[model samples]
Target: MYDEFTIAAYERNGFAVIPALFSAEELEEIERQLEAHLRLDLASAPKGDVVFEADSERSLRCLFRIHERSVFFDQLMRDSRLIQLVRQLFNGADVIADGTMLIDKAPLTTYEFPWHQDNAYQFWNPPDAVAVTLALDDSTAESGAIVCLAGSHRESILPHQPSGVFGASRSLVTPPNADEYPPVTLSLKPGDVSLHHVSTIHRTGPNHTSKHRRNLGFAYHTSRSVCDNAAADQYKRDLEKFLQTQ
Candidate 1:
């Protein structure tokens, strides 16, 4: 359920978790589709194990072509419940498309997503681009969970060092001193959703669990007119091809 404080928290803290958003059936549906897509990719992957993990981070799979890969995910992409949440965050504007992807982080140690803003790879559109992360598993700091600095979205977009959406690191002016701020744990059960602004500073730690920790992130935007970056559109298209071939 959402509240005034919750909305305000997103405004002030840069991220807010809307609790108990997805039903049990909904979570199962997403997982079913995700696993199916993973298997399809595995079938055609090259010889030997294709660890699917982007980097040092362990992963069972990473997929972006949901429509081409799984009907279940395509259904969730336009699910009435998901659309409503997207509408609420983007101010009731119908989404032109769904993006980012369904990411699966497998259990391991010593992997962490360096801090970065979603908009860095994006068009740097302040307050326009948003990502809704749906938890398909319990999110704990040790399990490669999302963490963010509250109110960091208010700042300007920092130039990106450029990495895969799930693999790159953000260029920090000066890594935060120990006395600065500690990362916040985004603990959530399956079906919990967190909506974050594009400029919000965020990162996740390694998934220490042997079991997979999965999440489907819907990058919602009004339209390409709002994105204002042709190169990014190209990048997104390029990413889709990577998914289909994998």
Candidate 2:
């Protein structure tokens, strides 16, 4: 549960970390189910509706439309605690999960997620959504835990260019300018969860340590937020093409 101080922190900084919100057992189940789902995704993706990362076929970058892929993820997105916190963030407005992603940073991986805003990729209107990153593995600074700007969401949407990651399109990337916002590391233990506004500037560094940095991410938006179907579709098509290159 969040206290007044925590709520104020979220309101002011556009991000907050709720520690140990989930139990260790729950985190284990999530990781187990995710591995199973990812195996299925890798085996039947592209030819099937599932998607993979842009660079490596074996890396398993993210599982999109995750709610439809498995009941566990569906339940997670609909979990009472998640909904309650999201509603509080949205000022009691009804919320819906617009998207879900399973991000994996393999041990000693060099994947660099340049600082960017979630809204830059999703292109949702009103940009009033919160993303929850639930750590399935211990995320430490050495293991490439996510770094965020304290209150960058309060600023206007900065200019975003193409990431040049082969399959990534202009809309798919927003490389961060580090000088604009101060960065703060959000180290998390398994079962810990961190939430950030859609427009909050954030990024994950490379995994220098020998531990997998796996996280289940959910994007929750109020029912009042509008979707740009055309933009979303284009991104999907671009992503699909990107996967084929791998």
Candidate 3:
């Protein structure tokens, strides 16, 4: 369960870890259900460089195609405990945009997620609220767990991205202001969770260990106050329909 402190931490830091939210056995089972499908998806993607970990024997990515694989993820997607949290944090009026098992942060030495926020996304009460990162495995700094800037989200909506060019997972910290952005490492084990605000500046680096640290990132949102820009409302009328065409 979460509390005022937990919510406040998330508000101030844009992220906070919730301890032991899933059983090890449950995680193991979920991974078992996801591994094969993920591997197959990775092998078939037209662009390998964009998705797979920069330098690791990573398998599949399910987030891109979760709606189609209903059998494997349907019940989990409909999880009441998860949905309840979304409603509580976003204060209801939210919906599940999408999700899938993000597997094998391929423990090696070269995987990292670039700094970015889902805030640009229009599916929620406002991306500024929060999203969920449910750990399916033990998450640690060395294992390529999430690292977040304390409260960058409340400031500028500037893209937390790199300049010059793109390469690997990058931090948005820049000169003269890098010190202004302090990042904290979140350590969590299976069953534990972390709530990251949309504007929460965050990223992950490659796993330096020999074992894969698999985690599932469950992204959520509430009906945004912004005007519906073209396909926005239409897409919500049928998330699956819109996705199938993609």
Candidate 4:
């Protein structure tokens, strides 16, 4: 459950870290489920939905549309506690999940996620959206944990350019005064979670340590936030093209 201070921190800083969102045993079961999914042939996965890090066949870069692929992920998205958090964040408004992703940052790999805002990629009309990343492994700065610019969501969405990585976008570190905003690294243990607004500027470095970093991320949008259908469709086409080349 979200306390008043937690909600206020999220409102003021555009993000908050919640410890023990899941228990250790629950995390173990989730990892087991994910490993079962991973054992399947890549060709069996929906095209353009799963991605890998460059030249690393075993390094899962991202898995999109996870709720559609697995009942476990779908249940996670619909959990009562998660629903309550979403409603609380959005002032009791109805919430719907727009996307879910599983990201893996392989150990000792250079897989940097460029700084960008979530809404910049989708460009929702009212931009009322939230994202949560639940750490499946102990995430540290050395293992590519996410770092966000505190309170950056208060500013308008910044310009983003295609980063040549499928479905990935990058932003300049100048406009929001990245130096002034001060980055907050979200170091989380297994079952810990971090939540951020749609327009929060965030990124992570490569995993330089020996431990693999894995997280399940979900994006939720309030009923009041509407996506630009045309842009969304066009993005899908572009994403398809990019994935085909990978």
Best by the lDDT measure: 4
Can you give the lDDT of residue 12 in candidate 1? 73
Q: Against the hidden reference, what TM-scores do the models get?
A: 0.79, 0.86, 0.73, 0.93
Residue-level lDDT tens digits of model 3 in 188-220: 788788888777777777788887676766666
RMSD of each: 4.7, 3.0, 5.9, 1.9
lDDT for 191 in candidate 4 is 93
TM-score preference between candidates 3 and 4, better one = 4
Candidate 3 regions exceeding 4 Å error are 39-50, 53-63, 101-103, 120-125, 160-178, 225-246
Which digits, one per residue and each the tens of the lDDT, describe model 2 over residues 23-74? 9788778878887887676666545343345455466555556787678788
Which candidate achieves the best TM-score against the true structure?
A: 4
Model 4 Cα displacement at 182 (Å)? 1.2
Residue 227, model 1: Cα distance from true site in angstroms: 2.0
Name every residue pair that clashes in candidate 1.
144-205
TM-score-better candidate, 1 vs 3: 1
Tell me the TM-score of model 3. Answer: 0.73
Name the regions of candidate 4 deviating beyond 4 angstroms: 170-176, 244-246
Candidate 1 per-residue lDDT over residues 79-185, each given as its tens digit:
77767665666566656545636667776645567778877667744446678888988888767889887777777776655343334424454444333444566
lDDT of each: 0.67, 0.77, 0.60, 0.82
